[model samples]
Target: MSIYIDPAVALSLRGYEMPERLGFGTAMAPVMFRAVCQDGCWSNGELIPYEPLSVDPAAKVLHYAQSCFEGMKAYRTGEGIALFRPEKNAERMAYSAKRLCMPPVPESLFLDGVRTVAAYCANLVPGNSGESLYLRPFLIGTQADLTVSASTSYEFYVIASPSEAYHSGNMRLWVEREDARAAVGGTGDAKVGGNYAGSLLSIGRLKERGYDQSLWLNPADRSSVDELSGMNFFAVIDGALHTPALNGSILEGITRFSLIDLARNLGYKVVEGTIHIDELLGQVASGTCTEAFACGTAAIISPISVIGDDGGSYKLSQVPGPVAQHLRQALLDIQEGRVEDHFNWMLSVETVEV
Candidate 1:
């Protein structure tokens, strides 16, 4: 399909200036990518000004919650500007859309939308370490129907943010025992708004109790470790890296995947297995587990210092884990083009002339 570049988009981008301080996704780029689908047909994507969206009050997304999104970054590497494994984000978004009973966005269209945004907004890509142009691509059921069914129409949007790295340093995590963010057979593995919405209350309650994020447990067993609110969980036990195995419920994090590979390449033993919460806490207490951390696209790696519940608090011997620190830097080096792209992961983007 043909892509349209609106003349107004260029003006919008040129007039845009980066704020002095960008708090994660709060700083929005001036232009955005938009496309619509009707009766299972997709229109050509367009580059347009970022503006408030118009949606009917009775839209299906408003009621049934058929929405999905992917988080990615456009990095300013030493060579030039580029994106990190965008195709993975595209594939994951399609998986998420399918889980919500929505049509999967075609890969070519997804790549085009993000690449165009990154190319045109290359000037907005942050130059500092751990900073980049954050990209959020989302699709919502827009058929303006109140029926409890999937909408026949949809709208896809790609928005950009020039922002700082999310650093939840030496976090104190709460062992969430009550609320289940996603169920055993639910959208736990999918990156959808509802899953995050369900987790907010837990995060809020934890924050009130002096914790950073919720360490959610498996919905089925309610015993094994699942993941953090949005990131994957990892622990360092006896000088080896251990994480929860994928069981059709954990959201497969791109960073988590990269870290495992990077750790092994760096000569650390990485294991993916089921970790019971009680057992892990005991290990922490016994000094067998020295470090733990959560990882995702936004934060890259956030070290976890303590795990607490009503019973007690268990602290890791290492506040900022050696494995986490090593892997985080290794991944960032490859991402920032400081080291060789041995994994062949980074995708370069030639900036579009304004």
Candidate 2:
């Protein structure tokens, strides 16, 4: 189906000004891609002037929290503008929708929506290293009903923002023992709004304690480390890489798996298994674990400087270790087109005649 572009989109794109500081998600594109699904049938997408949404006060998404979102990026590559692992984001969005009992946006439609936005807003793709046009694709149940059932109608939107890396320098994390962000056998693994909503209080409390983010443990046992509020956790023990194994509560981050593959390819021993919180702390204190970091699409790789708890603060021997630095540069090289994309992860988007 052909995508329709509103005539006003051109005017909006022409009149927009680039922000001096393109911090994460602050500089939104002037045009947006949108499509509606009614009774399980998806409509043709349209590119309209970016404006405020008209969500009903009693919509299911407003009351029941029936929404899912994906975070992906478009980069200025050797082949012009391109997207990084968009297919992975599409597949993950489908998984999140199914877990929420909402109708999944067809994969073809999902791709078309993102591509249309990126193609038209190609000029928004930043030229700085580690900067790109961040794309946010979301689905919401739109039926205005007060009942506790899935809405029959849904709205899908693709929006773009020219942004730099989310979290740049080393970070301090708090060991959260009292609040559980996600529970086992729940929507922990799914990329939904509710999962993130449940984590706000923990992050809020952690900030008061002089911590940057929360290190959440497994809700079932409350002993093994699961993940951070929005990113996956990783540690460098001795000379190898260790991360928590998938236990249905940790969102399988695209950047996390890509780093695992990129690390193994670069001759590093990467292990995915359960990491006990107390034991890991002891290892950090004893200098057995030298470095740690968190990974996600927005914050590619942020080194962990300290892990604080009721006991005390444990400082990493190296704020940014050799291994973390090496991997981060290697991944950025592939993303920014400094080197060949041996992994074939980028999907090039044609620049539209805007």
Candidate 3:
């Protein structure tokens, strides 16, 4: 598919300046990639100056929350600017769009939107380890109507930000017992906006109690571990890596999947199964579960120092333990191009002339 480059995009890119402080997704790039779908027909993609979107007040996205997004990164690698497993992101976003009853952005179009934005903004991709050009590709329903149904029109956009690691410090998680982030047969597995919106209340409550994130339990039983609010949960127990099995309510994170492969390659016994929260806490208390961490695109791996529950706090023996440190460094080495991309994860993108 052909991508149209707006003339103003060059001006915006030229005029924009990077700030000294880049905190996660706070700093935005000057250009954006966009496309529209009307009645199942998608338009050609376009790269334009980043600006406020003009949407009707009665749009389905505003009222019905028919929106899904994906988070990925463009890294300044040894060879050039590279995207880490972008195809996986495209596939996931397609799955998310399908869950919302919206037209999935074709994989080619999704790749074009991300690659075009990353190629043009190659200079904006940060060179620091753990820092990169954070890409957010999203699809939203745009049909203007008050009735509740899927929108006939949709908008897909790719915006970027130069960001540092999402969380640099060890996290203290709250074992959420009162609320469920996603329903049993709901949009939990999909990266939709409503799933996150429903989780904010739990996060807010946890923050008030001096916690970093909410470790959600399976909605079906509320006993087995599901995942953290936005990231996948992992724990090192008895010298093996254990993560929650992908039940219907868990969002299968790309980083989580990669870690499983990398860990097994590094000779660690990796297990994916139902991890009950109580058993995990008991193991932690017994020193069998030495360390725990969360993984996602933004925060590659954040060590968990403590798990707070109503009963009491269960602390891990090591914060940023040997396993997490090794895995994080291993992943970063490949992402920053310090090591070979044996897994064929990084896809290099040539810089485009503005």
Query: Candidate 1 lDDT, tens digit per residue, 1-354?
Result: 788999999899889889999889998999999999998899999999999999999999999999999999999998899899999999999999999999989999999999999999999998989999999999999887677888999999999999887774678899999989889789999999999999999999999999999999999998999999889999999888999999878999999998888888889999999999998999999999999999999998999999997789999899787778888888999999999999999999989878
Model 1 compared with the native: what TM-score? 0.98
Q: Write the per-residue lDDT of candidate 3 for residues 8-35, one digit (tens) a residue.
A: 9989998889999999899899999999
Top model by lDDT, which number? 3
Clashes of each: 0, 0, 0
Report the C-alpha lDDT of model 2 over 110-160, residue by residue, as the tens digit.
999999999999888899988989999999999998999999999999999
Better-scoring candidate (TM-score), 1 or 3: 3
Model 2 lDDT at residue 148? 92
**Which of 1 and 2 is the better model by lDDT?**
2
Candidates ranked, most accurate by lDDT first: 3, 2, 1
Q: For model 3, what is the alpha-carbon lDDT of residue 89? A: 98
Prediction 2 global C-alpha lDDT: 0.93
